[model samples]
Target: MQVFVTGTAGFIGYHLARRLLEDGHVVTGFDGVTDYYDVSLKRSRLAALQQYPQFSAIEGRLEDAGLLSETLERAQAEIVVHLAAQAGVRYSIEQPQSYISANLVGTANLLEAVRAHKPRHLLMASTSSVYGGNTKLPFSERDAADAPISLYAATKKSNEVMAHSYAHLFDIPTTMLRFFTVYGPWGRPDMALFKFVSAILAGQPIEIFGEGKMRRDFTFVDDLIEAMIRIMPLRPELGQPLQGDSLSAVAPYRVVNLAGGHPELLMDFVAAIETALGHKAAYTIKPMQAGDPRETAADTALLRELVGDLPRTPIKAGVASFVAWYRQYYRV
Candidate 1:
């Protein structure tokens, strides 16, 4: 299958594109490679994908609707995975306009491109942050996720609704994946795990949010990728919602959580990193930052129903793999 993937320079996008190429699928990667964190890291990821003969990439912004449309037409993609966006909660608070342009307008353009092209399967990313103000122990697909504390989460939530509208109107098969705190090798620099690892390796103080009381359903990137691979072919049908599924009754669209279904404390996660690096990290506990959640736990019962088994990468092992990659990547 020929796949059109956005954000190929990103951490998840890089890994996903590589896996698709390995599986003998032709991938047309698209990324702007903005200097959101480190452009060098993005270039390195793109370089890795360039090694594959079946992989090709485009350097452009999603805000360029004409380019996106032309690229989609040229690729003639059977499947489309939209992963490019302005990510980061605190960053969203700081640069709310960036989120508006990338997450909102950019997503709107992508949806228009996909709607015009009409791929067999359209899988875009959402976030667990949408489950804001829902103090439930484990969040379920059946739960209402109307409240979003951060602009980033709000934009993602808007993406879900906007995609549903397109799915219903255009009869497109769409799946919005609500990802938990995903981390592993080739992780984003702005993520907590990467920040912690960098600080620990440099013997710098690692800032702890919520006074180290936050817990997250930290899903490993490999596990999340595997789930996506298995789900790519499982497109939803109209008026055929599964039992307890988040599938829309009106459209052939559903919102699924890609999570480990296990919540680990922030300190426990730091401990896993410490154990992996064989070094103690200096901690600076502080109040929770805006647009950040206190705790996140996924009720992946519907995910299990869809994919049979859940991703079970332990925190320690995932952290260890990331640490090894970090050491090799930075020679630290």
Candidate 2:
């Protein structure tokens, strides 16, 4: 199988591409190499992928309409996984325009490319943040996600709608995965675990937003890739939706939440990092920022019924793996 994956240089994308390549699939990766975080880290990830003969990567943004179209056609991608986006909730608040250009507009460009060269399955990344302002304990696919608290969440929700339209109009079998807080080895620096680990290791005070009261469903990266691969083979049909809360009814488009199933407290997560690194964190508590949810817990029963399993990576073990990788990679 030949797969076209965007954001190949990203944490999740890198892991996903590696897994696909190891599974004997030819993968073509598209990434912009943006300076949103450490560009060197992105480069290092791409470098590792380039070692695989079956993997090819192109450095370009999703909004580059011409480049994206050409690559999609050239790769002759059978499966398209759109993961490239200007990701970060707090960053979205400061730079809303970037989110619009990448998450929203970039998604539109990818959809256009997919429309031109229809794939067997189009799996794109959405975030659990779309369940904004919803007081629901465990958010399910059937819940109404009309109210997004941030521009980032709004764009992801818009992507779901946009993809649904494409699926309905063009009969594209599409799945929008609403990922929970994904964390693991080679993770992004912006995420809580990564930031906390780095600050603690460097003997710096880690900022605790919302006074360490927030909770998140932190899914491990390997489990995330496995679930994605499993779901890729099962495409939804045009009109027939799966029974129960498994699939969408309107079109061949359904939003599935891939999560760890357990929402861990922020302080507990920080404690896990401290335990792993053998050091306590210097904490500076602060108020919660706008567009930030106090807690995120996924109702992954729909995902489990479809894929038959959810991410089961325990926080302590996951943090240890990340710390080991970070030390090795940075030679700390």
Best by lDDT: 1
TM-score of each model, paired residue for residue: 0.99, 0.98
**Candidate 2 regions with alpha-carbon error over 4 angstroms:** none
What clash count goes with each model? 0, 0
lDDT of each: 0.93, 0.91
For model 1, name the residue pairs that clash: none
Off by over 4 Å in 1: none
> Top model by TM-score, which number?
1
Compared with the true structure, model 2 gives a TM-score of 0.98
Candidate 1: C-alpha RMSD after superposition: 0.8
Which stretch of 10 consecutive residues in model 2 shows the poorest summed lDDT? 238-247
Tens digits of per-residue lDDT for model 1, 307-329: 89855899999999999999999
Q: In candidate 2, what are the lDDT values of residues 1-332, reduced to their tens digit?
A: 99999999999999999999999999999999999999999999999999999999889999899999999999999999999999998899899999999988899999999999999999999999999999978988899999899999999999999999999888899999999999999999998888888888889999999888999898888889989999998888856665555455667887888997899998998888989999988999999988899999998877878888555878899989999999999998
